[model samples]
Target: MATWSDFENAEPEMAEAGKKLLYQFGVGLAFLATVRKDGAPRLHPICPTVVNGRLYALIVDSHKRNDLRRDGRYALHTFPPVDVDDEFLVMGRAKLIEDPEVAEMVRKDQVARGMTSTNDELAFEFGIERAMHAKYPGGHGTWPPKYSIWKER
Candidate 1:
């Protein structure tokens, strides 16, 4: 697994493209998929933040949070584009961020971005195992969209 920084350092363009797709509306948003205790998949909207080159999400106490606590495996897909089929997907494992200093930094970043967060929210940092970015310049009309896939090497 690789940190966001490591992925970015290896493939800056891919990382930036993925980041752009993730934060398409000036705020980060993605569909986070986790595994339920019954081994089923659970999907939910999440606001993902890339701070100091690390990907973090603030999750309140819920089934999603509990899911991560029990099983860290997750896959994140960008919300569909308004006028295009361009998409980004990442597969990774999440680690709960417990260090006070790191959480404080994230809080400051969220405040600066005008995003509201509560004290009950827990932070989780994602470690990327691989990612795929697809660009559909011609939208649905295109025969095949350009694809760029990256894996930790």
Candidate 2:
């Protein structure tokens, strides 16, 4: 599996603007991955919000939802957009938290974004493993080794 050693050492946390950029234009681009009943990895996209280093998402009766219910193992994928056509990927593990107040807050945000109106959804916290950034546009600005991640040696 890919590890952190292969990537550049960004600070323990991203800059405030960088963090916000990941969420601003990344509403519908957040993806979740989990294991299916048969034990295969399944990936799905959903509306997501970040709070205190956790990613909260809502899905309507999705296969991924079932997978997450069966197993808390999941990941959140987000891309940070750049004006120079650059892309950054954040990879991490996730855990679902079932709290009425938290769920209600997420539901309210979802409604505001026109994503959903029900509070019957799941909330997750992702332990970010690594972040990889690369230049896009397929030109001289692109960097070598297209992408990398944080992993244990």
Candidate 3:
């Protein structure tokens, strides 16, 4: 289990490529895939934040959160670009972010955003096990795009 910082240190180019695709929309937009209790697959949109030397996502009380709690394995993929198929994908483990200060900061941010704030809020830190980024041409559908991939040693 490696933090985003660790991943960056290990493979800066790949990490940067993935990060760019992730935040291409001016926000950390990606879809999170988690394992359900019954071994089914569950997915949800998430905003990944890279701060404090790690990757975190604010997922309030929900089945997705529970999935992470019970099983940390996850796969997160960036949303498709408006035209190009450039995208990023990461597969790794997730753990609850328990730092009080970090939690407070997130709570405040949520409040400022006018989103519902509650004690049920759960912050998760994602550890990167592997990642890949694809760069497509014509900013649209293009197969066999350039791919940069990395994995933990």
Candidate 4:
């Protein structure tokens, strides 16, 4: 798996496009898919944060957190665009952020951006195995969109 910075370094344009889509709402909003204990999929709306070349999600104490803890596999899909058909996605393993300093910095940045409440929660950074972006020529009506994909070497 590669860090977000590594992905960006390898595919700058693709990474930037993905980032734009992920934060298109002026905040981070995505559909996070995690593996459940039963081997089914659990989907949740999530706000993701990119800080210092890393991608993180602060998860409260919930079933989603438990799912991630039990199985780190995850796929994050960017929220649908209102006027376009552009999409971004990343698949990876989520690793708990054990360093308090890193977690605190992420929390501070999220607070400054007014993206979340001041709550201490579990933080996980994604170790990306693959990333992809799809761009349509027009809106959703367009057919056969262009796709750009990257995978960890």
In model 3, what lDDT does residue 15 have?
A: 81
- Full ranking by TM-score: 4, 1, 3, 2
Question: What are the per-residue Cα lDDT tens digits for candidate 3 across 1-153?
Answer: 988998899888878887787777776779999999999999999877677568887887899999999999999999887767787888899999888889767666545544455567788889999988888866675677888888888
Q: Write the per-residue lDDT of candidate 1 for residues 26-145, one digit (tens) a residue.
A: 778899999999999999998888999898888889999999999999999999888888889988899999998898787777667667888778889999999899999786667588
lDDT of 4 at 19: 87
- Tens-digit lDDT string for candidate 2 (1-153): 222222223443332333454566635355567778888888877676655444566655667777766676666555545444445455555556667787677677667665655555676545556555443556445545344334423
Candidate lDDT values, in order: 0.89, 0.56, 0.83, 0.89
How many backbone clashes does every candidate have? 0, 4, 4, 0
**What is the TM-score of candidate 3?**
0.88
User: Which residue pairs does candidate 1 place in steric collision?
Assistant: none
TM-score winner: 4
Residue 126, candidate 2: how far off, in angstroms?
2.8
Q: What's the TM-score of each model vs. the native?
A: 0.94, 0.64, 0.88, 0.96
* Candidate closer to the true structure by TM-score (higher is better), 3 or 4: 4
